[model samples]
Target: MGLLWGLIIGGLAGWIAGNLTRGGGFGLLGNIIVGLVGGFLGGVLFRLLGLAATGMIGSLVMSVIGAVLLIFIVGKIKGRR
Candidate 1:
């Protein structure tokens, strides 16, 4: 199912983003949440930048980029709080 694939890719993207950002993961649920949101964000960002992601690998890369940006924003916000 498409939802299943989304979850899988999102989880993977989140995991990769976590590792890239903090040298670790955010657990299964965390990763999924982060990944899903990241996917959405990435889609918007890429489109705005005149980019279109296709296929599994493309989707994953976009998600990771968005996730990394999300994490960075969150960190900055948290730090300010």
Candidate 2:
């Protein structure tokens, strides 16, 4: 199904993003969670900005970017503690 593919792709994207950004901080489940949420966030962000992703690759790219951004923000907040 579409949702299944989305999860798989999102997971992969998230894993890649994590590795690239922070040497892979979150575990598998965490990455997938971040991916899915990131996908939603990316879509919403694009829409609000009057932009659109082109295809699966584009979506994944945007999602990964969002996930990395989210992780960075989390890291910043956590570092203060």
Candidate 3:
């Protein structure tokens, strides 16, 4: 159940992040991967800042923010190589 929610939220967050940042997404599987990782990153970041989010919407917001940051960073790294 948790895993299912994670995947759904992650996919949505990744898609949103990709569209917001780069004007597109990295396909279904890619989005899922990016989003899941981004969710983890977001949790860590929010904790560091003493921030908290509640419910599905809040989780989605945090995940999207993190996914965007992750995508941006990855883009920069790839551009340099």
Candidate 4:
């Protein structure tokens, strides 16, 4: 199912993004949330930039990029609090 695949890809992308940015993951739930939101953000960003990504790997790349950006922004905001 599409939902199942989305979760799987999102989780992986989130985990990868966390690891890449902070050297670790944000647990299962956090990763899923981050990844799913990141996927949406990535899609929008790509669309705005007139970019396209096809297939699993491409999706993963976009998701990870978005996840990393999201995490960074959140970290900055939290740090200011």
Winning candidate number (TM-score): 1
Question: What TM-score does structure 3 among the candidates reach?
Answer: 0.94
Question: Residue-wise lDDT of candidate 4 within 2-66, one digit each (tens)?
Answer: 89988999999999999999999999988988999998889888999999989988898889988
Instruction: Kindly report which residue stretches of model 3 are placed more than 4 angstroms away from their true locations once superposed.
Output: none
Candidate 3 per-residue lDDT over residues 7-49, each given as its tens digit: 9999999999999998998899999988998988888889999
Residues forming the 10-long window of minimal summed lDDT in candidate 2 = 22-31
Model 4 global lDDT (CA atoms, 0 to 1): 0.92
lDDT of 2 by residue, 1-81 (tens): 888888886897789878978887377788788888878887887888898898788888889877877777888999999
Give candidate 4 misplaced runs (Cα > 4 Å).
none
Each candidate's lDDT (Cα)? 0.96, 0.82, 0.91, 0.92
Q: Any runs in candidate 2 off by more than 4 Å, and if so which? A: none
In model 1, the clashing pairs are none
Which pairs clash inside model 2? none
Tens-digit lDDT track of model 1 for 7-62: 99999999999999999999999999999999999999999999999999999999
Q: For this target, which candidate reaches the highest lDDT against the unseen true structure?
A: 1
TM-score of each: 0.98, 0.85, 0.94, 0.94
